[model samples]
Target: MRKLALNDEILLKIEKPARYIGNEVNSVMKDKNEVDIRFAMCFPDVYEIGMSNLGMAILYDMFNKREDVWCERLFSPWTDLDKIMREKKIPLFALESQEPVRDFDFLGITLGYEMCYTNVLQLLDLSQIPFLAKERGEEFPLVIGGGACAYNPEPLAEFFDLFYIGEGETAYDALFDAYIANKKAGGTKKDFLLKAAQIPGIYVPAFYDVTYQEDGTIASFTPNQPEAPSKVEKQLVMDMDRDYNFLEAPVVPFIKATQDRVTLEIQRGCIRGCRFCQAGMIYRPTRERDIEDLKEAARIMLKNTGHEEISLSSLSSSDYSELKELVNFLIDEFRDKAVNISLPSLRIDAFALDVMSKVQDVKKSSLTFAPEAGSQRLRNVINKGLTEEDILHGAGQAFEGGWNRVKLYFMLGLPTETEEDMKGIAHLAEKIAERYYEIPKDKRNGKVQINVSTSFFVPKPFTPFQWAPMFREEEFIEKAKIVKNEIRSQLNQRSIRYSWHEPDVTVLEGFLARGDRRSSKVILKAYEKGALYDAWSESFRYDIWKEAFAETGVDMEFYTLRERDTDEILPWDFIDAGVSKEFLIREWKQAKAETVTPNCRQRCSGCGAKRYGGGVCHEGQN
Candidate 1:
């Protein structure tokens, strides 16, 4: 049995004692003395949240597969335990071996969201590691960063020694072997980093110098070291069906995770090509897994974890080619065992309704639709490809199928959005309520429940909207109020419920999403002033962030609320994300013109992901 890091008394004081204890089912264990490399993998969040990330589980499995490496897991302690640990001088340790992270060979932190910036500092501080990469010497573990947030790492560049700019499955093994080779040859930290910089996907920010113009825009970004590549291209697994192990036997957390179910990823990348969506652009050239392979993987996952529910994970679940077949297979396999099958991100069309009706309880389940815009013109601008008629038709099908509740998701402040667009949201919800009444009284399952939600738009890097300007906090609130009032005047007002996201949080996310190297100082200062857990609405302090930005002389408007010229050098321009700038610029022009582009399944738009030479690019060719 592995010894617990915290004593019985200390564990009792924490909210979830299962978080600190090790020896969970399916968790790997090895003698540290027998391994050549001791790597500590961290998600920089609470254990419950971190354990649910599929990327962390994939890397953990990959790293431990090596006989010469012993990889362990660590997470940021909750604020309750954080205070106690600091006062008692308890160093942060990994769960597997109960060993201090300060003693590990390499500490890799995954940066999934921008709001977790402050929590990164907490993880470093609690581990007794240097907060700045420059302060850490050869004696300390090398701190590396990766994930979607790493696409624009300049804001947090000074803190991470290196950033992996690609899929973990494609490049991690090569990077790890290179590190092992450098270590056996008696290499220093600097020497190892210098060698690691030569790898295709590895980026050592220290080797690069960023210069800003008088207008506060990136003037020049050039490499200072010979080994560092000027443009680090994003890596991807070409043949996911053959090369990728979607999800092997992962560690079943003792505490219930946020996603406490067997998550089977059906595919990678999205063909929808929504201009405002960063994930769809970054994960280009949609690739799907074989149905047989997915079935086997799901079986293994369920067997290893004993989860009663299994969710089909994907950017667009309905876009999968074999979705109907896969859903039918799952229902046939698990329905007898009383296992719940979750199918999210599906368009509420006839096929979706048919499948959902079979798998889900019509009375309890709610139908969801992402129109992404209120008016048809705004929908065209964002390339959502969802028509108002499509919405009503789908709702009609769902209502006929005994689902009385409907949820509509839209975005406010989209580029070129007008007041009419805002009112159109309420109009659409009213129409859905009308459609619910169109059903016979005896056929209706219950009263019509139409829930409408809207969030302020925040343009992200690598997307066509990357150059678009964002609304100020007050403007966002005003727009939300406009939609709320319009909903109140609806004929079926009682049936309609409207909710909007926090404007302050939206603006803050805008600042972080598009910030450059200069914004790092503001983040550092904010964290010093108790800005941890900023992702949580209750923990976020808008005044603290404003003060930090003011003190650092970093204007939030410089990053947000300003449209950039087409030729301007963005913060994330240094990395090649497979999609060409030319394609993105073309799409941006189309967005302004309100022109719709066909998806990958219909015709190739030449987005430049084809250079990788696989996936949907050659789907019809073969």
Candidate 2:
């Protein structure tokens, strides 16, 4: 529990020294004796990246608001620091108090994605705590995980003692209260975890016995106690407006983070229910806060952080009901001081462009649009409602306006995609270039630049494409090469640039995304083989993943390239995500027929979310 003195010479040798020093504006500090439950909110990455996460800020603020609880931040040290820590035997410590993470009563890790699994183990090991739940005694810190990855916690079930399945707003409060009562009774960690498992959204891994068949499928999962629910329902915050108040002022990092400026979330969830998008399915029923509240938050954030740029972020910023008014208000408020307003998720529409032109002061800022697919038929198959005309019109508007650089995002191997459909990607880019040329020279502000980025499609769970087969690495690479060759041969435009994600990396992601408990062994093995950040292409080692899969006797292709039957139970079935299986199956059928389902906000396709509703539709709300 001793505070480690800063070695200035070693700090200078490492990258981003400011990341290690965690003191910042709006950070919470409290006396350990004053709190009943001491919680360490851990993010499995460096401090700069972890501090930037809005969820961490919200939870930190909420827990500290409680007079009886104190929560602090914990992050994995960088590689150089990790080595130094091992040599010096420095235990992982919290930022606010500089106390060892092992000293906390509860260690709560917020898992955002699959890539951070290794860092979780590393963090635990560095803290001198047992990595596995069974290995750790009752005296050890209670290890719990939450966030998006917790929705499918089967893979990491062996490591975590419990999981908070959904939103933490209400569940977190319930958990801490239960812990306090258990502590008053002088209960053990096991006793407390057993009681905590009875909570609505909590899942205790120790109480469940997972049996696997010879084919590596889950045979059964039996609970040891009657207190556990048969299926844990994901917790959802009914009111987003009330929740936004919990995040009044986020901590500004000392160093430049990935998102270096103030980010105000304009809305939650997406109404355009694209079949391939996991985020849309996971965050169902789009909800927006009041525009006045958003403007006020932005103004406060700008004044506190002195951030030159403010990004209005959401799944789709253009879909916000009062986007024009929000933009105008921000522009009018910040124009005199030269603050930049950025709409991060603008849809491909004329009105969105018009709003952007009015709000964005910099004419040189690049515009980005995601058509998702090349052709209209392919787009329909993925439930991407954007038509070819929408892209053309949107690009035309950008060209007609002062903006010259346009970036378009697309996917390579979608379900039911063909070579002709792949070729259509190049054809569409050439057409956009042609449209740029058609614009008058005076209107065309500068040389036109068309940047196309293609990424391999990885089938995710809880989506319409969950049962679809992903293309093999070889096939994906071939298709990408074909698209690149076709574009160069046909259009031969110098201003147009094409880049693609590595297919091998996508194959690894595919294996992890839809994998079962058995995949955990593969992940652990790969991590031991130095797979720190597999998501980054430069750091990804395909051989390590391949070797891990081979050693574990788990077939990567069987999980990635094989389609599952509709009646089959998935690994994530035990966790209820609010969406019905019947609705997903129907959407899958529609996708196969190349039929598009309209956004639920516009029309009710009976997706079953109305069962838990504030207002079923926009008209219903009206």
lDDT of 1 by residue, 54-155 (tens): 889888998898899999999888899899989998999998999899999889999999989999999899899888899999889999999999999988
What digit string (tens of lDDT, one per residue) describes model 2 on residues 1-622?
4353346876887777676666778777777998898999999987877877877777887888899999888787888888888888988888778778888888999998777788888888888898788899867788999988787788888888899987778688889999999999999888898889889899998787778777666788778877777798877765777754446667777778777778887777778889998788777767788787888888888888878888888888878889888888888888888888777888857777777787766655788879878889999999888888888888888888777888989999999999989988888888888888898777777778889899999888889899999888899999999889878975536877999999888887787788777778887887778777665556667898888888878788988888888877687888878777888999999999999898876688776666656533444741
lDDT of each: 0.90, 0.82
lDDT at position 562, candidate 2: 86
Q: Which candidate has the highest lDDT of all?
A: 1
Error (Å) of candidate 1 at residue 433 is: 0.7
Instruction: List candidate 2 segments past 4 Å from native.
Output: 1-6, 361-363, 615-622
**Candidate 2 global lDDT:** 0.82
Q: Score every model by TM-score.
A: 0.98, 0.96
Q: Give the clashing pairs for model 1.
A: none
Q: Candidate 1: deviation at residue 258, Å?
A: 1.3
TM-score of 2: 0.96
| Candidate 1: regions farther than 4 A off | none
Clashing residue pairs in candidate 2 are: none
